[model samples]
Target: MKPVRRRIRRHFGLTAKQVAVRSKRPWYFQWGITVLYVVFGYGIAYWQFAGAEDVHQKLRQTALENQTLHTKIIQVERQLQIEQAAQTNLAQQLNKVQDENMHIKQDLVFYKNITNAKRLAK
Candidate 1:
């Protein structure tokens, strides 16, 4: 293993002492980088998850509103249908009354003719 390392160092034109010194960074620098990565990664993760939660809440609220509006629309449509039926019934009643009125007017004209004829004959 030592011979292999020496051969690798020779190939890279590095002394064993220099390789050892360059391989190990200062303890503080290593710890500082680790701490920074942990803090930044946690912050990013928290922000993403929180934002997703907010979006999910908004979606739920919108869905509820949409459902409510749909129910209201259905209710309005049902009421409109009932009103239309009532209007149709009223129109039929009006037509029947008008027909009755026409018949009464014709009977009145017939009675007037009969009375006038009898008076003229007398």
Candidate 2:
């Protein structure tokens, strides 16, 4: 068979030595493009991190507000319970006073009836 290296060189019109030579311009240009891409990626990541931190702080403040509101509700309910108990006690005392007033009226009527009967007999 014909030599393989000679066959490949003839087909592409390039000697092996020419294919191995590297140019400086394209190599440096590729490195500059890569650096720009890295800087852009880092800037985007930093902005996203800042936004996340702001959201986290707002959530923390909202949670604290929720806890404060819950405590206020509990305290108000306790005060309402105390007021209701005082109202119940006042109602019971008013009923007892009315019962005592009814008994005093009955005793006055019985004493008047007995004194009238003794005067009629005389």
Candidate 3:
């Protein structure tokens, strides 16, 4: 019984010591891991910055395109307004000409009736 207990204690003590030794790794290995982590972090930061810059450039391009389109739309709208105004003016002029033609036709009829009356009297 005593030998069995001693063997169990020795096994447990060796396990604890192994665990402690593994927990304390060499300084060079720890520094290498820290350097690798720093490099990886820097790489990630650079990748994010590059992506953001690309997005910014795209946004500027889109904004310029939008501004150009907006200006074109304004120009088109102004042209349409001018054309509509000209059409309205043309319609008014056409109405005035038709009214004048109607008046001339009435006068011609009156003159023909007067001439016919003079001929009948003779």
Estimate TM-scores for all models.
0.60, 0.50, 0.58
- Model 3 alpha-carbon miss at residue 65, Å: 0.7
Off by over 4 Å in 3: 1-48
Best first by TM-score, ranked: 1, 3, 2
**TM-score head-to-head 1 vs 3, winner:** 1
Which residue pairs overlap in candidate 3's backbone? Answer: none
Given candidate 2, what's the lDDT at residue 114?
Answer: 87
Candidate 2 Cα RMSD (Å)? 10.7
Ranking by lDDT: 1, 3, 2
TM-score of 3: 0.58
Of 2 and 3, which scores higher on TM-score?
A: 3
lDDT by residue (tens digit), candidate 3, 1-122:
99988888777865544544357789999999999999999999999998998999999999999999999999999999999999999999999999999999999999999999999999
